[model samples]
Target: MKVAVSVLGLAAIAAAHGYHEEDQTPIEGPHNALWYNTLPGDGGTQADSVFSGISTFGRIQYHPCLTSRSVKYDIAFIGAPFDTGTSYRPGARFGPSGIRQGSRRLNLYLPLCSRRVGFSGGYNVPLKANPFNSWAKVIDCGDIPVTSYDNGYALQQIEDGHNLLLSRAPYTDADKPGPAKKDRTLPRLITLGGDHTITLPLLRSINREYGPVSVIHFDSHLDTWKPKVFGGSPSQQASINHGTYFFHAAQEGLLANDSNIHAGIRTTLSGPSDYENDGYCGFQIVEAREIDKIGTDGIIKKIRERVGTEKPVYLSIDIDTLDPAFAPATGTPETGGWTTRELRTIIRGLEGINLIAADIVEVAPAYDTNAELTTMAAADTLYEVMTLMVKKGPLSGMKEKEERLELKA
Candidate 1:
């Protein structure tokens, strides 16, 4: 009787939640939801069909499920909407929504109609190149339901949610390998930010998968300040904060500090100890002004040298890494930053960094202008990350030497 009742209850719940598509097509996509979804149901305006088809990235479908029994996922995009950790500004809670909204207006193809830089296809239905199939399964898992009434609980919830995704299998049986293996091999996580503080919890979850991964952080601030909670300060107790989580993560052995590096740092220091604090936390600094001296290729060479192709890596991009002229909607804006194209080229140069996971953070839409360049840059940056994950080979020769080894093997 209990088993029968349980089945009935589950069936009822699924029925209540299922989309009752009467004549809706069962399939769509060149990029999984691309071409077929464009025409959605017959007899609608172009605008209507575009918006109504798929509500996620560039008309991609929204998929909120993350269970072993469900279809495996290669990449899962989700949002973290809590920004109580912000020290200077607080509107980043809207970052994820802003990014998604901006992405809908952007095309998925390399140049909207060519595959020279990316995949070959028209703007509406983008295709992928050889070995990096456009058919790769990416699911938008939706936002973590963080209400922010309790900060600690909210942080833990984010960590738990991330761990849950990392622990599951990708949709392909080949990706999973063995039926007995509890977790899949190559599925990755792309997170849209609540704030930089989310990185600490995210790293904690990832540590369980590949211990102490080297980090390639692109930010305008060092983010290694010590929290007031340390040393048992007589003032009110402090918690893990955006400005201080990297310090804690390093102290807790959560990062391969010696191998980690920060790019585009230009924030004013509180004291001489600020740079020292960052050094102690285990990161090499690449100042924003250094870009002019070293140029894009120099910066790429330095990053590849610091985070060699051997170890697993994580990329944390704060929107402020781009100059305010390019991305002005971040909470902590800093001057003298890289251009969006420069950043894109640098990221592209890191084709074989063994990137395990990544997140684009600190995009506050409230501060943006009607142009929406800040959020749009964040969306474009996310696209660069996806390309980095799914690319086949270098554009020309002069590839990283380690890649030659990979090809030979």
Candidate 2:
């Protein structure tokens, strides 16, 4: 009798719902004029039919979701199409397209539950009055326009292009009279990778505008090696090279102090000298072995102590941080590293903290055969981070307690 009532209730609800043609489109509603419109019914204004047809690419509407009101967006998916900083393979430039292609296979639902939640439970949530109703607004703001060569200039161009997309308020003559106050207002820009080096300029821009920002760097190497190959040239292989981004960031005064950066460093190939005299000054390093010892909880606690509760945090993930068994196609793969589950735990633990911006770097698809592991992991990680951003108001420890109760139940 209860089962029959449930079926009848579901049928009644379905009958009462009015299904519109726009509901079938990827982007389903009104948005800011500047956002990309990929929904099939969007009247071909923003993206061409071919680009709009793919689910991975969608329109961005400007509105308040997490941050303040200033060109606010649900989410912006950007592609960084270059890899000049790679030390081994020369194919990470293709990473953005490959990852996007792989992302197309993702269902617009959390993998754990079949409900629509936008690439895992990262964006969809229930309204207070209606638990059954879930909504999410996401956009593919298009790729970070980049060239194939002149990496130094390319990095600058990528940063400028991203800035243009991220810029909310244009400066008019009236607004330009006084010195521009550091505008803390910007979109929660979620960037895809050309290589890990691409993160350098983005981080710089974020820090310049928002002041001191905490960092959660997930990678195999420390990326703290001072660039010696390019002889101080402004090439991507110089200060912003994949291997030396954080090192230079610290040197350039982007990170506040040692305590502001938490290097979730797993695999390593550097000598002892790399640690003693590296430019990372006093940054904290969480080795994989230590993570095995103290557990993810302990690592989270340590990160909290270092980064503190107040500052806005940035998460930069180099896909190579995962063990080769899990992410083998990355340009730099290390044997001993976090598993996918372990990595997820670390991200899940950081919930409720101020996540200002994030990026997933170093996904070299040219080396990937099945396209199963690296890109999937990238998508999952991106989902988890974005979800944390949306639900940032909730306390981290409180969420953990609730999870424990659910498990017991």
TM-score of each: 0.77, 0.71
Estimate, for each residue in 168-214, the C-alpha lDDT of model 2 and write its tens digit.
43212212211112422344578889888888888767655566566
Deviation in angstroms for 225 in model 1?
A: 1.0
What is candidate 2's local distance difference test score? 0.61
User: Cα RMSD to native, each candidate?
Assistant: 12.7, 9.9
Residue 5's lDDT within candidate 2 is 62
Question: Per-residue lDDT of 1-409 in model 1, one digit per residue for the tens?
Answer: 6644654554465346541234112222344323222122422111223334455654455776543336456677888887888878888889988898777654433212111112212121122332223546666787877767776788888888888887666554434232112332646788999899899889988887667879999999888877763333233224577877788789889899699999988988767777886788779998888888889989999999999976678999999999999998998898889999998888877877777789999999999999989988998778777766655222111123435667999
Model 1 misplaced regions, further than 4 Å: 1-54, 66-69, 108-135, 173-184, 229-237, 392-409
Query: Which residues of candidate 2, in runs, are more than 4 Å off?
Result: 1-52, 55-74, 105-137, 169-183, 229-239, 279-281, 393-409
Top candidate on TM-score is 1
